[model samples]
Target: MKQTGIPLAAPSNPNHSRSLSVGQSIRHSFARYRGVVVALSLGTLLSGCGVINNMMYKTTGDVMQGFSREHTIPYLMESGDLAMGCAMSEATAPLLMSFGRVTDEPDQLAVMLYLSAGGCAEDQGREHELAALAAMYERKGNAAEDAMIRQKRAYALASKRYLKSWQHHNTYYGESGTGECPDFDDDLDEFIYLAGLLSGLQALNAEIQSTSSIGVPKNVGSIVARASSCLENDKWWGAPMALKATVWAMIPGAQPEGEDAFDRLAMTDRLGEEAGVRLSHVFHAIAATNKGDEAMVKSVVRRHAESLKEQPANAEWAFVDAMATNIIVSISDRLWVENTGHRTPLGQLGSFWDDQQKEVETMDLDGLL
Candidate 1:
């Protein structure tokens, strides 16, 4: 049964309660949860009007739908705690999937569930990539002769997880070169779909970086170009621009006529900062790493570090923001392990060996003892 007397969109006045008001709301709650309402009413009354209003709002379907936009999706995007977010998403997968059972393919709930599942897979892929980095470090050390083998295994796993992420995207939105637009509920859903496309490309990039045996796909450049064309630069906090700039920087001659890769990358950096996402910096840093341009890498890293210091709080699109930081940190961590036989310095995550003042440093000796 659909609940009425609730506004589908936000009420024009913040203080305006719906037509149901408190008495009707109480009756509706009583009807839905009779005994349960009686037990909860005492505590709710003690908590004041705010709590009671919240309880009433939640009883309505419209409010519940709004809850997904304001709370559920934002939490998915902006959460700082990666482990907890992954666990929660995994736990809710069944419920999210259940929504799809009753809803059509183009339904909002279906899109949300698929986007969230894609995120879960992306997180798992990052974990596998981290494992690969650890194994790469082991290969650099003297004691681990099997590290190369382990690194290869981890990279393979990461690639698979990324593929899983994209598969979620393909389930509803279809794949690239399909010659169609996904029938999304709105702009937000379309943004999420495009983000999934980027996630898949990121997985391919990771695999290519990890091993020379697996070559980059010839069609990858066209895929990036097509993905970049779907959305305006402003959508989803300039994510599309970031994707476009990253491709230009990474793929030689990919930049459009009269436009340089450096200029496009610079524009992405500005857009990311304006949007408070800073994901473009992450992409730029990775591209620099791929090119072995140590100077460019250091420049990107320093700017990223400064940006983080300025806006440490990720109040919006938290997941994307954190993922960007995670990638940049991994890049620095690898550089540190390769040079100093240790991870990046405590709290100095993005700084690398090039920042060191001297080539030689003091070492502990048995003679000193």
Candidate 2:
């Protein structure tokens, strides 16, 4: 009943995606992540290709065992970094929800990276290496000294504090200007932009506390201020996508309330070009408001809706869906030339996401997003 928690998304028919046997998907996933697969290849050959997620990473590894391909993925020697990167990748995956197998793990590996890296069986999202370091110092170091005990206690406290802060860290970033915004910067987590936001916040808090006498509070005031200015001025970098919806509403002769949130952003030309498809959503939004133009509205909405339907199921993201939905409502989406806005959503106005347009168009963005 619930697909990825987005009520609006049309559930994807398996037909939209190429259905492969477990072996096939595994082979494809393994091929792309060959470095990880090579470690497990021996097992694949020995076990007749049954090994997948279970063997690749297990609860505990045989540290003494030498390259047990049948039981383990050959150590990437790089999984440490891979783990961290994957964590970030997954966190950001929500933005580009359906890209590929990369995000398909549902950020599981990413979360595992945090758990593994944090070295927690319970998954508090701490960096495991940091935990191991404290353990090493606490038990191996001179336990005979009082300072040593105090030192260990301090480390324990620091770790706890870092963990607590992360639990409360903000992950909700506003993406739509149609609703209320909290002083414009309340949602920006620059430290953890995309996936690593909380971890980033946790890391920063830990680093500062580890290095300083008193823990410095997370100060995002300046960053948040700058982010708001960027939005007001249409600076897309480090900017929240929520403002994008407002921008879409601003096309002339479009929705009347759309202009309510319009702030003249600088570099309008570039931003317009970058968000052409998203901007197309503004036209779609306006089309929804046009009463007499039912035929044109339906045509525009259907065309954009079709594009949404055709959006890559693997790559269809939240913004992509929202933009597609927004675009269908835009009046310009239905117009050819004379009635369109000065800046068309992206280049032409139909569909966008350059990486998309090709492999994605056929996937049914509507069903996928």
Candidate 3:
């Protein structure tokens, strides 16, 4: 057997060699472009992730904000537990405020939360004040001074928080008294407006108590008094009038002509008592305390205690009534602590340590026995 070798034939078209070269060039170009395509795709994917994350955050913040305003606030308002409300506000404020980084800030909620948190700080300050009083009673001068320092520090913190509340309020509602009252969206909006006014006034009061330059505006008192007129005194359970009267009592010449501050306070007290809200009592007591009118303070407390017995708190606004009562109790405690070195005894809110005893018919009781 013999083996035969065959030679390959040449390409039919002359351009076949050119076509091969072109194909090779195309393949090389695609290979180089593949890296660039991969880079572009990765960049697009990362950009999409950023968009998705932002949308998620915004949605979450919106839902949380709505739920808090609609459900949480109303439920809290119905509750009578001031301590629990204060604690919740203090704990959740930071978490809620952080959402502002991703979305619009919840300024209305900030007003309420910061105000409540400021109250918590004020309560701490009161505790220190009580301790200072106790130390003074014991003649411990150094201990009293130290407690006073701590009290002022707590008050300073309270003032700062309250001022923040006032600032946020201005952000949300625009500068108050710049023009006509804001067109309130609903009852909640009106309520928040009132709260904002209270926040400004409280910021001023707290700064004064702190004895520190916390930068609270001195004109806040007058502003709050004027702003308070926006709310109807009767609709808000006499709170608006009480706020105005309190300003008049505190700020010299703030009262308008023919308006007696004490008379307005007395009228508001009756209105509050009738409404079962009784927030006016707090204002009256505060003004009395500021004036060093111990008798007036005691009268306010006694009247409040009597009103509680005469009329229960309105069911829809029990929390507000309860808070007013809590403040009254604190005032009573301060008086008791100052004189008796203790808080008011349980079941004796209206009575004092030196209250006059009523005469009893001892002979009739013995004969009956």
Candidate 4:
């Protein structure tokens, strides 16, 4: 056999050595990614052998859609462009759904599409929320009369998108433990099921924040409380605890006897810190912000900032890593935009509050941010 491709060579400049190293690194990553793609394609072909495959195209469609959702989505989100990300999701979701046309378990594909669609909507909703907050700041600075109107419109759109996210989640994971949804196995399947619950709750929170028109229903609280029990200690770190704490904090008189919302939040915060995934901190900060508890918000933000400084997010789960950054950065962005007319300070994204101790002054614009 003869080698045909270009031969590898060292760079002349030692400084340019990093370029070769980076290219090699990319090659290794692509090798692994290609293996996954090859495996899926092989599996798809192996399953499409005869009448059996014809009868079970549902399984085939599921495998293909899963690949699309898993591979395409994270890249779109990691691009750091929300409008483009949402647009990509909108375009890809229907392609995944089209796979369901030949499947018996059509709703299975719908569940996945709805979940992905909900996430897409959430990205748009957060963009709207940030814009609304910016508009509110403009009004505070004595802007034109239309500033208030723009703020209101932005909030309305944010609320509408969040409502859509919640509705999509509800369609699949209907009121936990109700036996109304599809069956799921343990391990990753269970984790995904729980994630749906978390997604629905998150959307509801956003909706309430933007419009104040929605209330935490008692039934939903009960469902989340019940669902939290299924999450084991090792599987989700503090996610289940975070969910419980969020429910307790949001619903009026929902906390159990001898337990407080802050206490639960603190415990979840510790767990998230240990796990090196600080989603609980985001939940805590948001809940505290809603309560107008500035101290608690700062506490959560500072702790999360410190943790992120200690260790950057793991790249193995880059979607979650990006999400953690997005949430924490949003907190910093809120503070900076309100105080200095900017987003997170340069190079101080995760450690903004802790390192700089930048105090966000209180403004008189209804505390919207």
Candidate 5:
């Protein structure tokens, strides 16, 4: 009844004859007017809205009937695909936790994440309860402990699923041939890993909030740092991906993969400030560990106050940016176990794209805009 991990595209899009090569996909993404390449195809805007209910779910018929194999498969294969995949994956986590079913494909993830966000945002009593039940599987401890445990389970499961999606879409070397990357970095795979780190950090943050689990939150930050380190000192694309990576790595004790990734992915442009925000998580972690300068811990909160917008013309760019937004917001929201703000934690739960409950929705971009 469910799929697994992130699957950027379908297995095929039969329209292979008309499909753009990997290189073309990247170019098409950047040219706004080109609007030529984006998968949104038709008036994709709200086509799938029905499937989501109040969440704007789309119906199956809209996606599948007209979708070409070419569009689906290549989308699945591309780097940005993971962004959607992770979103979908996390969006749907609550259902997976409740149903005890998980999917292997990332597209399915879209539905999960969307749902998780919606549920968490609105505080649907039943969905939240079901999510708590799902948390029981991986977390340990008592009732209060259990509630927290459930929270961590949600974050970790979400984090793990998202990690797989980013790893799947990116190559350690990046897609230079396709101009899909910002620059060269061996340790960092373009800015995509940034998405992984963002999702992971959010997971860790949420997990920490739900539970007093000591190790997980720290580890989440560590992963963020590691992902950042992956691109450190490298010519990061200055896109959302790199910025996200920087923020995660900057988290005081997040994932300490090493200084290498950091050096490789450092900012060469204005991206430094955004990257700095990610590091706030690291600093917060450091404060928690007593290894950091607590004074610096305030940076994250301050950074969020700083408005930063990186326009993403295509799926990959937008996906990464959205992932980063959630991660950062979650960090600020979950900065303390006190969850003192009473802000609802972002559900690091499931995918937003799990239409297995329905059918694929499609819009013929050729006719839409």
Candidate 6:
């Protein structure tokens, strides 16, 4: 009779009941803290995103820095396209410098970029100077004044940028004239060091030309002159000696006793010519111009032009040679514009307006007849 009725089920085991209760407790805890779990998941996702972003930025910066140092700079150095080099420096500097926000500041690259961009500005200033001369020759007083103003403005910009380049150079290689030279890793490093020295000198010169307070140190000329000793004059195509000589020529009392600035410049000229990198000629011309020695300036230009005919540019440093030629041409153009109201005539970089024409020996058709 008991079996016919519904039999009572055996009681569940206490351990089983306890396990069920624990499972419920876990679910309840999870439900209560669901918002916290979601927040944690979101935080993890965001943190991962930040890591990925940082990695991407780092990769981009590394690639840009490497490409610039390895390929871009070397290629530009080998090429003889001054305009293209200037354009590239002007265009890419901001973009490259922007990487500093996320990565190490590219101080080494900044030295080159600012140096080049300063050159671009200086070139524009030269052009304005030429325009001013042209306007003066034509008796256009207002135009001449405007052009001179523009020229000074450009020079001021150039001074600022050149100063920035020098600053970056110091940042990367320690300050020059610190009583110890940096241990250069390679030729490129040495070259950059030399460039930094040049940038410093140029900064001071440009500031003087600008007639504006660009805060270039007054002692930069002496500092660069001292630092130039770190480099081998002959190894760098006489550039070190040329730099030192220019400073001596420019700064009063800078010339040490028994050291003739002009004589040293003359020696450097020969050295530069033999190397097919006549940067010394530019320095010579600048010194002569500052001294108001028109004859010497013309002689330097003539020598440079003749040297170009006798020796082609060194293939390894064609761009540097080309740059020297460009500056020399600008100097010639200034002379031409002042006297003849125009730039140097095409194919006449070394020729001047006042030169005596050589007698041309013509074939005697009449004698043949």
Residue 235 Cα positional deviation in candidate 1, in Å, after optimal superposition:
3.5
Error of 2 at 332 (Å): 13
For model 4, name the residue pairs that clash. Answer: none
Residue lDDT tens for model 3, 1-369: 565575367799989999999999999999999999999999999999999999999999988889988888888888889999999999999999988999889998999999989989999998999899888878889999999999999999999999999999999998886646888988878888988888899999999999999999889988888888888899998999899999999988888999998899999999999999999999999999998999999999999999999999988778889989988998998899899877889989988988968888666677777
Please rank every candidate by TM-score, starting with the best.
3, 6, 4, 1, 5, 2
lDDT of each: 0.64, 0.35, 0.91, 0.62, 0.39, 0.92
lDDT of 2: 0.35
Q: After superposition, how far is residue 45 of candidate 5 from its true place, in Å?
A: 42
Better of 2 and 6 by TM-score: 6
How many residue pairs clash per model?
Answer: 3, 37, 0, 0, 107, 0
Using all chains and alpha carbons, the TM-scores for the candidates as numbered come to 0.64, 0.21, 0.89, 0.65, 0.35, 0.88
TM-score, candidate 4, is: 0.65
For residues 69-118, could you state the per-residue lDDT of candidate 4 as single tens digits?
A: 46554444345454454465467657656665765333333443444455
Instruction: Candidate 1: give the clashing pairs.
Output: 77-318, 77-319, 78-318
- Candidate 1 lDDT, 1-369, residue by residue in tens: 979998689877765676549778898877989777777897677778866665554454454455765578766676777666657655765654444333333234334444444445544444444444555566644334355545555555445445555556667566664556666777567766766667566567657645633343556545756766667776665667667767776777776788766667777887777667888887788767767898888788778888887776457677778767776776776666666656678888656666668768878897789
lDDT of 6 by residue, 1-369 (tens): 446666477546748778989999999999999999999999999999999999899889989988998888888988999999999999999999988988899999999999999999999999999999999999999999999999999999999999999999999998798678889888888888988998999999899888999999999999999899989999999999999999999899999999999999999999999999899999999999999999999999999999999988988789889999999999998888889898888998778988969899999899899
- For candidate 2, the per-residue lDDT at 118 reads 30
4 against 6, candidate with superior TM-score: 6
Ranking by lDDT: 6, 3, 1, 4, 5, 2
Supply candidate 2's per-residue lDDT for 33: 90
Cα deviation at 4, candidate 1, in Å, is 88
User: RMSDs, each prediction?
Assistant: 19.6, 33.6, 4.0, 23.0, 28.8, 5.1
| 10 residues in a row with least lDDT, candidate 4 | 104-113
